[model samples]
Target: MSNSTHISTLIKERTGLDVGTQFRADLETILHDLAKGDLEQYLADLRATNENAPPWQTLMRALTISETYFFRDSAPFQLLRQPILPNIILERRHHKRLELNVWSAGCSTGEEAYSLAILLYELLPDLDSWTIRLKASDINNHAVQIARQGIYREWAFRHTNNGFQTRYFDPAPGGWQIKPHIQRMVSFSQNNLLNEVPRPQFDLVFCRNVLLYIANDFTKAIETLIFDSLIPGGWLIMGQSEAIRWQRERWTTHVFADATLYQKPLPHQIMTPPSRYPIASIPAMPDYELALDALYNERSSEAEQILKGILAEKPGHAPTHILLAYILGSRHALSSAHRHLDDALNSDGMLADAHYLRATLFLEEGKDVESREALRAALYCQRDHPLAALMLGNLYASIGDMAKASRTWESARQAVIGLPPETRVSVLSDMTAAGFDALVKGQLGIANK
Candidate 1:
């Protein structure tokens, strides 16, 4: 076998990590750095060392980015802080058993696991009575060591508030140290999800952002492992982009405002967790709201699914079509996205977001004429649409129309300035008013130059 193919196969066999084209460059760099440009020697060394050895650990560090922070997404944590954990607490209380088990799989640097411990502390007032097992594991040994240390720099606390920092962390040399009590709640270990056994004990399994990196061949195996690890009625929270695609009907899908979770249903037992936007409240409003919530949380797949279902029932649903188009556009299915946008505009030509998204798709494909028309339509529909205005201004500037670009950008700035900085431009968008303002201001400065 060629050295490249052999190395990739060896990595798959040893680590179950995908050495796909995206990672080929990184693999070559690792070989050069570790083996002094000798591919055969690196292969020999890799084969000789077991997973727990220093060589394997160093390889893992290079392969995995370990880019994470405390309460990284905030949505799953919100779901846990509410109905999930509270419901578990009630059921356990009824059985006169105060015990909780949680697994944070692929917990890079321990931020997520520590976040869970802090959430539990806040939720359970009588915490001393409960027996908690928060097991956090990652394949990277270096990360595990850092997790055990429980110290993190300020960068890790970007999403965290000052009050939380003061309450749970003490200022230490070079960084902040997690309080002893919170540290005691968690146990860290080096673990590969591929090697995970079915324990059937955890009340919650958080395997977020881990499946995206696993080899496609091993993804199902890891998924099965995660499913088996959770007790009946236990919840599994994965990343926004990932979901249980295989045997999906076996698990109950819980659509929440901030997150979508899969629950292993109990045998012959129906589970209904309370929701702020309950599905039973109104006929179609709940599903639409759920879709909006999914979009807000960056759960594009979930939003797309719900929006499609809505479209199946009500084909003329302009809003649903617009949302589905946005999701499709994100996936680069431009033609499909354009069709959806056309359907939305047909239903309601006044839909500014639909026009804006269509403009974006057109711009992506380099159809400047069509894109400019769409942008104008969007601005006409909603005069204060910052995104449409910004894009239109940038389009003008690209053609060296500095005067028009500057005037359009000034309008864009005014449109964005009225909204709260933290307010999202739309439920279907991740950009906030503050971000839009920054973009316009940056463009204006460049235009003047």
Candidate 2:
């Protein structure tokens, strides 16, 4: 029962978004950084402005970390390719209309929405005959604009293995531009998830890796909205880390491999957890563990060999890909590392460790912006991420934003304090809550109370 502050209420009123305790540091950082410590004056200016959108949107933009690559998480895509798409297609076949409506809520730059379209094209033999609509929305207008453009850098294709780049993208002056048909498939709009999602009753909805940043009440409200947006039997997939505690009576939890899914069950459908998938698709037990051991001990080559061996057996084993990325990163094989990171996330976007590793890699390479995004993604995936908040706070310090940095450090301290003794986060950084507090107090001139 956390009470919302005035600033939090303002944000909630404007966008139906909550700046919860978890995001307090983030909000404070943005406000303090923008205002240069005179937050009250900034607030007054914001209040006086007729164009309320700018101030609010600026804060929102800073708060959002758009750290997405195309097909960064592949489990849901697998479900789509295997059964979801086929089932949806079959369900609508009786009407003689191959109609599909899909929504990618919080779609950063249209990669996910386009990925769905590509899957649809690949699966259906007669795609042209079908009435297809892939609608994508983001609260960030800049991201929405970028999504509409359909042009992206090489980095965006890191997780992409389907040769979609070869078939669907043309080399542009700056980067790769998606072709007309793929572009035509997805429609991007700037919309906040909390308030309005115009198109309802989607066959499949993707709101992956997006909800955990919001407050609990808003998250439930958003979930309710998603439930309402679905066709009776439509499936809703979230990020790997996000496990919905929705009332079992309304939805059936479907476990597929390491992925858990919720399907909007139709009338008279049982509300029990779906049985374990009978397919022998899970990675062989010892190899992944062995690979992890090799990775932690600095056996880069050995780890790569082990991971590659496992990958040959189970190409979709995302953890292997992530480990391989870490190994390659140590070797300064940055491009290769990006591919592995993308593939790992593509395989399972819920891997907070992978995002943490990506942040570490980015920091090593002196890519602070990329590291920030990676850290944010890691926190979003797993709030109790190891050293993520600390590193991000250090990153702000490096950028000379002491106010933001100090606030972030405080947040990290609070997070650590709340952790159970047994489940405490461990990182090689060897930094503790006491150490962080001392550093922040000394550097940022905070008074000891």
Candidate 3:
């Protein structure tokens, strides 16, 4: 085999890393740095079957970037503080089992794992009786060692409250030392994700910012392993930039205002956890026409107020929830829109229009996984949803599934034609029939009528 191929094989064999398709240039840089001037000698040494390979950890460390700080990105931590931890508390409360197990796969220097422990401490009450296993691991032993020390410089506290430093850490010589209670919550280890078996039934797993470093194939492998490791209804969080968009079958893209979390769906569960405030009495639900008329006439303020009144009264009314979500979505009130959508689905999981509207919201936000679930849910509820079919076709095209897109658009075309001439569909905005006509012609290669 060529030296480069052999080196790649060695990387995978020794480090469980695939280096990925964009590695050649990076490999050259690494080789140049390793050689300093003697490329030939370096290649020879790398290829040698001496069974005495130089400590691969140095190369692993050189290739991987480990820059991290407490609550880096902060969104997932915010999510933990809200619905995620609280719901877990509720689920286990009745059983008198307050058990929370968490893992940070690419712990780096333990910022993320500690941050999770802090969130648990801050958000939940009576945690003193809970069983908590917060484990953190990095491939780099040096990083693990530093993390075990539980000391941090000021830079790590940039995004964190100084109160956390005061409350959870004690001032020490080199830097502030993590308080014993906080430090005791976490166990630090050096782990190769591919080689190590993840502890199962974890309440949540933070595998963020780690998958992108591995090869595309290995990333998939790691994702599957994570999927298997999570208990039903457990949460998996990735880096904000990562794509859970394509992982619909394995995870529910639980889109929040600040973060998108992947949830291992509970078996036989339909929607997310039920709304805390379910309506007690059935109020007279209003027709969507008033809101639609106001919205279509550019009277969004009038429409929003009407929706607010209706929802405030009959929060249990699924159709009203869907319409409000639709109106709020058009106005780009995404956080509120998602809230209404979640409630609508919870009230009635088979609401096709609500699902379609949700799909469009995710699409506008550039979230594929989030969009995919809603689209699929829309189709699942009512397969002939023309707009959803069209958007699903668009989504298929986006992921380079042209053949599927072609077939899907063909179906979407028929669905569109089957609609009454006056039947209107709204995406980011209301799309005219003529617009849908041209959409298929341009996207599906249909000849002009």
- Clashing residue pairs in candidate 1 (N, C-alpha, C atoms within 3 angstroms): none
lDDT values for all models: 0.79, 0.70, 0.71
Across residues 1-449, which tens digit of lDDT does each residue of candidate 3 receive?
Answer: 65556666766665556663547667866756766766666666765632224444566566666888898987677446433565576557656677888989889988888888877765443457778989898888778888999899999899875366897899999898998888888999887787767556787989988876676656766787788888887888999888663456656775554567877877865355421211011111123456667878889788778777766754545656767787788789998888988987764455567788898889889889889888987766555566777888888888888888887788777666634455454422476656776777688873211
Candidate 2 lDDT over residue span 108-190, tens digit each: 88888888887776555456888888889888887788889989998999988665588779999788899888899898888
Top lDDT model = 1
TM-score of 1: 0.60
| Candidate 2 collision pairs | 72-345, 72-346, 73-346, 74-346
List where candidate 3 sits over 4 angstroms from the true fold.
1-5, 13-26, 32-54, 245-247, 270-449
lDDT for each residue of candidate 1 in 1-449, tens digit (9 for 90 to 100): 86656777887877678865548667777656866777787788889987778777877887886888998887677556533576577568768788999999999899999999998876665678889999999999999999999999999999885477888999999799999999999999997777777889999999988878878778888888988898998889998778876767778887754467888878754444332211010112457768878877778799889888877876656667777888899899999999998987764455677888999999999899999999998776556567788889989998999999999899888775556799766554677889978888899899878
Candidate 2 at residue 57, lDDT?
Answer: 64
- Evaluation by TM-score, superior candidate among 1 and 3: 1
Worst 10 residues of 1 by lDDT: 275-284
Which candidate wins on TM-score?
1
The C-alpha local distance difference test score for the whole of candidate 3 amounts to 0.71
Task: Output the lDDT of residue 155, model 3.
Answer: 90
Model 1 segments more than 4 A misplaced:
269-449
Per-model TM-score on C-alpha atoms = 0.60, 0.57, 0.56
Query: Residue 213: error of model 2 in Å?
Result: 0.5
